[model samples]
Target chain A: MAMSSALQNGLIQLQLFEEYSWVFNLLFYVIFVVFIFYGQRIQMYVMLREVEGSLFKLKYIKDEGRKIAIETIKEIGKPQTDPAVRVDRFLEYFTIGPQSLDPAGVVWKLEHILDIRDVRFKDEVKLMAPATDDTQAHNLENTLEAAMALNFIYKIIRHFYLLGKKTLSLYIIMQIQMILPLIMREAEAYASALKAFAYGQPIGDGAGALVAAKLMRGHEIRKVPKDCVVATVPIEGRTTFVMKAEGPGGNVGKIGDAIKTVIDENEGKIATIIMIDAAMKLEGEEVGEVAEGVGAAIGGPGVDQFKIEESILKHHIPINAVIVREDIGDAVSPMRKEIFESADKAIERIKQLMLERTKEGDKVIIAGVGNSIGIGQ
Target chain B: MSKTQSNATTRISSFVLLIIFLTLALSLTALILATTFFGQGNEIIAGYLLLIGFIGVALSTYVLFQTRRRMLRLRIEIPPIVTTIECRKCGFKSVREFQRGDYIFKEGEPCQKCNEKMLITAIYREVKDKEKTA
Candidate 1:
């Protein structure tokens, strides 16, 4: 009897459902239409929302960078007036790269522009922080530069976000969303860089410089052009001239000029030119892994690489490179243990390269090519 | 900066989370109703209700996962930096939190072992392995 009664109730519910079937069908159709017409729009909204979240985070990072810059300047520079305005202005400062329409002599043009920019920046930094010494000033300048990078990143992302919102263009929104992760990663790196610069700590980029310092320690040091320094050390009976940016300050000294000078001073008789630097590692590669290759391993606007290549070619010198592998984040942030330890390994590679590539009493030039922040000669 | 914009975003996200949870609860209720209808032998009603409940659950779960990924992307944590000091005379080494003026190869306080000045030999971040998530 209980089963029969349940069957009866089921029949009644079934009938009621039939009665409301049109309502269900109508609701389904409406939903299907809405999805078909607005599916892309909905997806775009979701992406926009995600981008908005990242944008907020970027803004916070940018603001924190600015704050740190101002504080460091105030603490070290001891400026008389408030530096907030000046800091903001400096953050907005920009450099227009040299025109490439006439590609000939572009490198020199770029070098000229870079020199002027550097001079102007130093002047501005000195004016803002009169109390700071040369090293302190350079460190402060690096810190401010990081802040400026963060500021620029935030503004660019904001511009794209606003543009996408204004046009409601899915393509526009999609493009920014696709690369947002990479952009955010770079911005965060710059954010961390501010601290490294402010504290004058050795960063991963200093790997090469550290190796040079290790080699040149206790040797007679001489200053070269473009804020570079060189020391003569004997390795395996070869007179090795180790060169690096003058440091314990944040500077990737004009490496190209330094190399050129060293070669000219030696009367173009330098047997081998070996460059050491930090390189971005590929996926699955270990940090601090040392690799040797043949080329100028310096990374920048290609100016230093060009100069080094030119000088080496003119002298019929073979250029070899020993690179310590690191990631983008590692390059900017404070030095990691693995990367720091790799300096010794890089030095080992340099010594081995010299022994294999050159003979006894041969004059060799070993250039440690990277920013020399928080590293000494 | 007031950070008014970020505060607004936080509020909006919270509201969104609440709405998603409410929708999830409603979806669970619909699933319960569909099961009840199936037990009563109301196949037609059970079929429609089951479809609706399943769609709701799937959509909500997807949205929840996406929200989580966005949150994870925004999380930033800075690691601590340490300075390693080593005495040249006795090879005694010690590490401490990094000080502002500390740089590689800088001279530090006299060593406890040999009374000779310790050199700031290395400064680097204390990297920690990230925890594996299931």
Candidate 2:
């Protein structure tokens, strides 16, 4: 009986010892196993959480962009239905570029696709905002397009993020994290563009259009092909035929077609095609600084530039480009004072080029290449 | 729920969590200091206190970072636009707030100096400090 009592006491002492030390031991073992077996997983989860936070911010920016679009449309368009639904649908619209496997007629095919997309987008805008005039309709289209861009960015980022989370792929998460800042910068740019487009303000992209407008102002304007306007203005005793995308509306007119038409009409007698455009400035470069170069100087899907190059090569004509430098942010956002002032500088450069390169009474084609949003001819 | 409302709720909850974590970190730090300086040779207690204190501080920092980021995201503001008009004949210039229909090269009211027609020569926003990229 005494031995039995002693055994019971020993068992009680063992129980008490375990009760005191079990928590620390369990913690130590759990931590050791987690660090050893699931360290990468824990790291991935932490990064995922971080990415999720950024994703949330992106969503907010996108939603704010959409809200601005809907409100602007409702205020200006006075649409019969709630534009929110139509705007949401329009935001999801996509365009598929033509295949280039054969590479023979891809440019024309791409241009045809772009034409159809443009018409469809305009028709969608008109259907949604039937009460708007032509100018208002164009502005609304631009605003919605910016909103659509934001939505696309958000969706794409969210796609990679969710895909990463689902597969627990550190590489995917790292890729997204590395490029997140650039993506966000672009998204913010589009967000700012919404305000400019909605209000029909001139953007830095319109610097080229502004230069043309200033030169072509008070001249007898004529319609060229594809929503473009041309006027004959005398610059330094030379007869200058200046052309630009018709404006006070948001349009990057069919510049390639217009240039082709103008060249065809003149029968290859054009001396020099002076193109002015807003060029993306390098870092540390001053905004609105005008630099002269030789090329097409147009920024898009290479369609218009191709056409210009083809026509120039056929006629063996000299093409000079005067670019007004602007940051990516400035290109789409409302114009800054520096950019607005650059128009005169661009004009002076063009006049100088004309004097040095062409003879008196030579026919010079000065094409201002940009989206003439709020600049009139 | 709407995205805005959801964002508001998330922001509020994050703020509350930040406060809680900060309070916890402060209390843990204080306890650690007290235990270190005045615990009178209780080494085990001090060791545990130090570990707990660091963990608490780390959590608080994480929460603080998140809350600050959300606040920054919420602070976006739209820029205001301005118009600069100048007369071609007299070179007189005037500045005004931008209207809806304003465009570059569009003729505005007559000039104040010479009664010549003033033209909308510029429409732009004043440069902000944040936009200056050195």
lDDT of 2: 0.86
Off by over 4 Å in 1: B1-75, B131-134
Residues A1-377 of candidate 2 have per-residue lDDT tens digits of 99997678667756766677878898999999989999988988888887887788778878988888999888888888898989999999999999988999999999999989999999998888888998888899999999899899989989999999889899999899888877887887887788889889999899999999989999999998898999999999988889999999999897878888888888989989999999999888999999999999999999999999999999999999999998788899898889988898999999999999999989899999998999988
Per-residue alpha-carbon lDDT of model 1 for A1-377, expressed as tens digits?
99999789878877897898899799999999999999999999999987998898898788878888999999999999998988988988989999999899999999999989999999989988989999999999999999999999999999999999999999999999999988987998897788889989899998999999999998999999989999999988999999999999999998899999989998899999999999999767888999999999999989889998899889999889999998888899889899988988888888889889999999999999888999987
lDDT values, one for every candidate:
0.88, 0.86
Best by lDDT: 1
Q: In candidate 2, which residue pairs clash? A: none
lDDT score of residue B98 within candidate 2: 85
True-vs-predicted CA distance for residue A364, candidate 1, Å: 0.6
